[model samples]
Target: MPDPFSLSVIVPVWREAPGIESSLKALASIREAGHQVIVVDAGSDDGTAVLAGPLCDRVLVSERGRGAQMNAGAAAAGGNLLLFLHADTRLPADAVTQLETFMTSRSAWGRFDVRLSGRRALFRVIAWFMNQRSRLTGVCTGDQAMFVRRDAFEALGGFRAQPLMEDVEFSRRLCLVSRPYCIHSPVITDSRRWEKLGPWRTIFLMWRLRWRYWRGESPESLAQAYRSDVRNA
Candidate 1:
């Protein structure tokens, strides 16, 4: 058993009106246990903050970017361990217990494997590849629900205020200090984006963006391209 520590789950959301309620509801057990839950809304007009306000310990309004919103949430968190969760991601029932145990014994920072919530067989393959790639590179994506020791996060200066690939950038910096735990238990994430964009197209675009990013392409340019592709898709 590892030393006990409180957890603060921070969820950065934008226009998540459709899923925010259910996501919060799913986290009821953790909240009931007196763990903190903070939802940072990115100026969503869809009542995202309103719905999330009563469910979470705190609701904050921030600039309309995932990275910015997440940093704001982390700034307001009270726990020693910070878990950054996606609005559409559903954590396992034992996530809180698992995290408490893992954090005490494992690396200072870690991420769970992701399971895409869809019936398509390709979704499984995509998740498998994603998990394997992350393991190989010691990099975890946002959808995988990354967590870190609060002191380490502050020392690393939180996440970079980039329009895209903030998780990638953060992971790169974090791995310089320690390798991620890479828990095998999975968090299920909604596959709406992949479904809407066509899985193959999304996969190709992601690979292209990652390749360009690795080659030193500007994040602003990559973000613009990504947004354009999403809109067109």
Candidate 2:
């Protein structure tokens, strides 16, 4: 028999009030399906916590950083399976069932493919490349909705305290233990970032950052460059 386990969906948010309601509502089915949802807010003054309070199973406040917030959520979570999700991402209807099935296999870590939400054709190409590159490199991004067994996550020491590329670093460490189950069913994520910033420019910026990271660049410096680029874009 497969290892029976519960799931906890952890969402790390900072100033995401504009979209938090819809995102939490999207997880209603998952909550109803008996999984737990935890929203870790990084001191958002936009009522993100109040708005999410009624929707999710738990609402936590933490220091302002995605990695920190997610770590706090994971520490407080009681489920055997921990799913790190972004505020703007929505899982597919069958996500829980799929994860449950995959947990029966030898793989202990995984992420779903991602589809950017937009009508632009460029978004399709970006999504394709993102999924294919992740499959080839075994490095998953936060947008991909990374999931892991709680025991495995704890053993790996959770996400590193970094401002950027935490997902990539965590995936690298995870691959040391087991190859990730790259689920082909895609999760839908907001494309506003790409829409606000030029799609191709954003893609190139990400690629550049990844290359720099691979070359042993400091995350703080990369994070500063990323914020500056986004602000100036």
Candidate 3:
């Protein structure tokens, strides 16, 4: 059967073997109803590309960076919509259909949903905050599965190859063109990072960074400190 969505799912990955396989399995269950899932490998040392090769439509390699990987995948894609997903994030089953409907109805520039990856009460608050804040500010994270119309995506020149917050930057532009749909079903991201950091501390760091971003600091600088601190701990 011909795919109804004519959409492409782009997953940016780096050193994500453990969670990658599970995420792929979930994505595979989504079926090939007319969409292609491409895993953009950011030079993963964990052999994620090898494992994902047979599962996804295509596995692409790029320098070790999320922005670069996503840009590469978007350039190689042959679909009308480009959905940038994270390696550690799981999309809803009807993600493709919802994206297609939005694109078809309004020719949507781009949209993203809330993230639900943890069971903790604090995690729920943070996730809810992310959803609300993005709607108010036009800034979103990659874990949200940002989907954009092909032409609109190209016009933004894709995501910058920064080490962080490239999703927020691209989304800022997307918001100017159209209001994000904010899909009802949210994407669930792996909570390992936050859990490892201690939930409260992790949420604190996130809120601090977000506050800094609101105060005009570069998101990369804020995120750099947070992610480095996490990796170092």
Candidate 4:
């Protein structure tokens, strides 16, 4: 018999009331499949928690940070597999079937390919590079919808508290355990940030940040720079 397993998708959000309901509603099929969906709210006063409550298995309150919030959700997750998804990203239609195959694979962690929800040609170009880079480096961003086996995640102690590049940091450590099983089906991620900053500017900004991070810059300083860049834009 195949190894029976369950999945828990943990989404961390803050003040995302406008889109929380829609995001959670998309996961209703997973919930009906006996999987779990947990939403972690970082004290969103915008009723984000309230909007997400009925849609998920649990709505948890946690410290204000993506890494911290995800850690809290992971702590409460009961499934053998855990998926850390972004609020503005939507998984592929066959995500559950893809994951079932992953559960039987020897790989301990994986991530989906990503596409931006923008009509621009540049958006496709950007996603192409993002996926290609991840494939070559064995590192992934949160937009890719990172997932891992529960035991593997626990052994690594989950995500560390960081203001930025938490996903990058975690992916680095995760790569040391086992290379990720790259899923070809893409997740559609919101392109609002890119469109807000202009695609070219956003691309350059990300390249600069990742270069700085590779050069041993502190995440706090990088985070401050990111906020400044976004604010100035």
Q: Per-prediction count of colliding residue pairs?
A: 0, 0, 1, 0
Cα shift from native, residue 114, model 4 (Å): 0.3
For candidate 3, the C-alpha RMSD (Å) to the true structure equals: 2.7
lDDT of each: 0.93, 0.93, 0.78, 0.95
Number of the candidate with higher TM-score, 1 or 3: 1
Model 4: which ten-residue window has the lowest total lDDT? 1-10
For residues 1-233, what per-residue lDDT tens digits would candidate 4 score against the true structure?
85478999999999999999999999999999999999999999999999998999999999999999999999999999999999999999999999999988899899999999999998999999999999999998999999999999999999989999999999999999999998899999999999999999999999999999999999999999999999999
**Candidate 3 wrongly placed segments (more than 4 Å):** 1-4, 29-31, 214-220
Show model 2 residue runs off by greater than 4 Å. Answer: 1-3
Top candidate by lDDT: 4
Residues 1-233 of candidate 3: C-alpha lDDT, one tens digit per residue: 53456778888888878778787888775545756788899777888889888888899999877889999999989887888888778788777667767866664555556665778778888788878887787677877888887888888788887776678778777788877777878888778777888877877777777677768887568767877878876
Clash list (residue pairs), candidate 2 = none
Worst-scoring 10-residue span by lDDT in model 2: 1-10
Cα RMSD to native, each candidate? 1.5, 1.0, 2.7, 1.0
lDDT of 1 at 198: 97
**lDDT of model 2, residue 204:** 86
Best by TM-score: 4
- Per-residue lDDT over 180-222 for candidate 2, one digit per residue giving the tens place of the 0 to 100 score: 9978889999999998888988988998999999999999999
Predicted structure 1, TM vs. truth: 0.97
lDDT: worst 10-residue window of model 1:
99-108
Give TM-scores for every candidate, taking all chains together and pairing residue i with residue i: 0.97, 0.98, 0.89, 0.98
Question: Tens digits of per-residue lDDT for model 1 on 1-233?
Answer: 64458899999999999989999999999999989999999999999999988898999999988899999999999999999999999999879878877766648799999999999999999999999999999988999999999989999999999999999999999999899987788999999999999999999999999999999999999999999999998
